[model samples]
Target chain A: MIRVVLLGAGNVAQHLYTALCNQTSVEVIQCYNRKGSKLHPDQKKELVTNTLTELVDADIYILAISDDAIEEVSSNLPFTNRLVVHTSGSVPMDTIHSSNRKGVFYPLQTFSKDKTVDFSTIPFCLEAENEKDYNLLKELGVTLSQKLYKISSQQRNALHVSAVFVNNFTNHLFSIGNDICSDNDIPFEILHPLIRETADKIATMNPDNAQTGPAIRNDHKTINRHIKFLSDTTQKELYQTLTKAIQSKYGKKL
Target chain B: MIRVVLLGAGNVAQHLYTALCNQTSVEVIQCYNRKGSKLHPDQKKELVTNTLTELVDADIYILAISDDAIEEVSSNLPFTNRLVVHTSGSVPMDTIHSSNRKGVFYPLQTFSKDKTVDFSTIPFCLEAENEKDYNLLKELGVTLSQKLYKISSQQRNALHVSAVFVNNFTNHLFSIGNDICSDNDIPFEILHPLIRETADKIATMNPDNAQTGPAIRNDHKTINRHIKFLSDTTQKELYQTLTKAIQSKYGKKL
Candidate 1:
């Protein structure tokens, strides 16, 4: 059995804890949070800790904390010379302290504390210092998901930025759509299917080929009309900036 | 039974043709395109016409052409005083020739000639001058889709603008993600599941509430790191602009 001491009680940490509990071959030896009250209520009191000194021996120690806290928490760990992996896309594996074997087990998905995500569909970006450590991380990754990527620190950094673009920026665009609908007294639900299909299209076709819009078509008349239609300055700015970006990418001149 | 004439030979017109051909109650009496070669290959020669004078009488005429052409084509039609609609999101219903009963039959989804979309999920945004014409358009809408909206020309205009943000801008964001992946030698497929989940999340939750990322979190350190990591000028500009936008939306001072 693979034993793990999970650090942090944030969204990713709780999600990881719940997913690991479902695996028959993996055991979460203990879950650590700065405040014991924040740990998952279902977790047994004996298997949870508020103090770093109380953490027990485990095959892997997964730090699923905030990016800013990662280095500090890893340096403060009581145990050493064991495998310690962080579930951060931005933080490097070397931030896990020199006393332990470093690795990364980043799950490339947006997480909410209240939402239960299906781990099977999430991509687990794994990284380790050696072949054995990589295989160990891969083993744990397979138990939770089939999509495992052995990414280097640099590659993972790039992936993290890309995630911000696709997930965060994409969601912001949806929010703008909602705002526009609200302004016009149109129900936001009307745009949901289009949003769903836009994402689904990319699953089968390249985004470059799948792109269709006034910007790509160089339909300056419609583009200008759209810009003039928007009352909000920021929305207009975003529309013009993104439109220009798409036009520049497609070699369409204004 | 309703007899119809479909105009234009573009993606939307072709999609509407294929969808309408499946209905037992509706018969597409004619397909009109300025260039005969542009008509769908499945359309029978007897039913296809390039000249406006050759257009036969039909219960409803759908000018599924460019926004600029809708006015000219409707005015140039051989017959008058019939239900004439243009399948444009931005174009107002009155853009059609005043001699004919004006209406809008916009299907609010991105269309590609090669991609086969599920018409059942597509939201058909219908508009007309009067109740009888609306019901006629709605009747045809019901044949192809379960979702229909009685949107006004003004509302449809706003919806069209919103569609650009959610579908077009969102797709551009995906292209940026793919570009970033390619730069790092990572397969773009790794981000596909995350992209799907991002869209899926908004289906249940408000995009404002569903938002997550360094920008939403106001993690200036990571944001700066990402901006520094990107070598492309346009990528950096987009990153900064979108980051500021999200931060502004969430009231996170940066």
Candidate 2:
């Protein structure tokens, strides 16, 4: 069985702690956070330490802190040649350089404290300093997730940028949709099915191939009408920029 | 039974044809395409004609052609006081100037020819010239869709802008994500579940409330690292613009 110490009790930390506690082959021996943070029920009996001195010796130390705090916590932790890993997508694996065996156990999915994560389906991107550490990290990842990907720090960083595009920027568009609906006295739910269907189509088709719009057809009349309909300056600018991008990509004029 | 003449053979026309055919109350009296395009298999036996003179008498006429073509086709149609309508989100209801009983029968969802639409769940945005025509259009919309919204031409145009943001622009972000994944040798499919989950969250939570990312957390270190990771000029520009937008929204730099 792999014994692990989890640091930080934020969203990612709570999620990983719960998953580890549920797994038969892994045991979360300790969970650490800044002072005053409560521990999960499962870790009530396990050491829930706030002090840096309480950092326990374990086979694996998983740092689930924020990107900025990773270095601060890593430097403070007592290193014992134990494998130290951080669950960050953008932070390089070397951030936890205090350990002899360092790696990343980054789950490429968002987590909320209330939401249950299906780790078996979540893709875990694993990176390590050496082959032995890589294999161990891969094994730990596979134990938690059915899909494990071996990616370098640089590649993972690219994936992180892409994640922002798909997740963060996409959400902003949805916000724009919601704003439009509210402004027009139309219930935002009217567009829910379309939003869901759009996402579903990409599962089987490439986004470039799945694209359909006035810009794709070079329908400038409708494009102009849409631009006129948008009253917000920021939204209008976004529409113009995206429409131009689409036009250039498809060799069409907007 | 409602006798209907469909006046186009494009994506919207094909989808509407199938949807109308599936309804027991609606009978397609004739199908008209300006170019006399090959009819879909289910529409084969239905009278297919290129000339408007061949059009049979019907209770309603649905012009599901392009926005620019709507006026030209509607002007040429042999209207016999039939409830004439055009299925376009951006086109004004008065585009079909041939009939005083003109209205819009816009299905407010993206329609691909091959993609089967769930008519029962799709929202039909209806607009008409008068109360009597509005009632007729509402009844027809109810037969095909569970949700019938009485929206004005102006409101429909606003919704269309919102649709562009949520659907077209969102899909482009997905394309960027896929490009980044392929460039890094990571399977784009790995991001599918996360993308779906993000959209799913918005169904229950507001997009602003559901937003989570480096920008949301004001993690400039990770954002800077991501900016460096994106090599393409367009992608770098997109990253900067989106990061700035998010930061501006949250009143913090990232």
Which lDDT value does model 2 have at B135?
Answer: 84
Taking all chains together, the TM-score of candidate 1 against the true structure is 0.96
A68, model 2: CA deviation in Å?
1.3
Best by lDDT: 1
Candidate 1 per-residue lDDT, tens place, A66-138, comes to 8889889889988788999999989988888998899999998888878888999999999999999999999
lDDT of 2 by residue, B115-153 (tens): 777888888899888898888788788888879889998
TM-score of chain B of each: 0.95, 0.93
User: Under CAPRI classification, how is model 1 graded?
Assistant: high
Expressed as tens digits, the lDDT of each residue in A68-185 for candidate 2 is 8888788777665778899998888887766557889999888877888888889898998889888888777877888888889888888888899999989988988998999989
What do the candidate models score in CA lDDT, each in turn? Answer: 0.90, 0.83
TM-scores for all candidates: the values are 0.96, 0.94
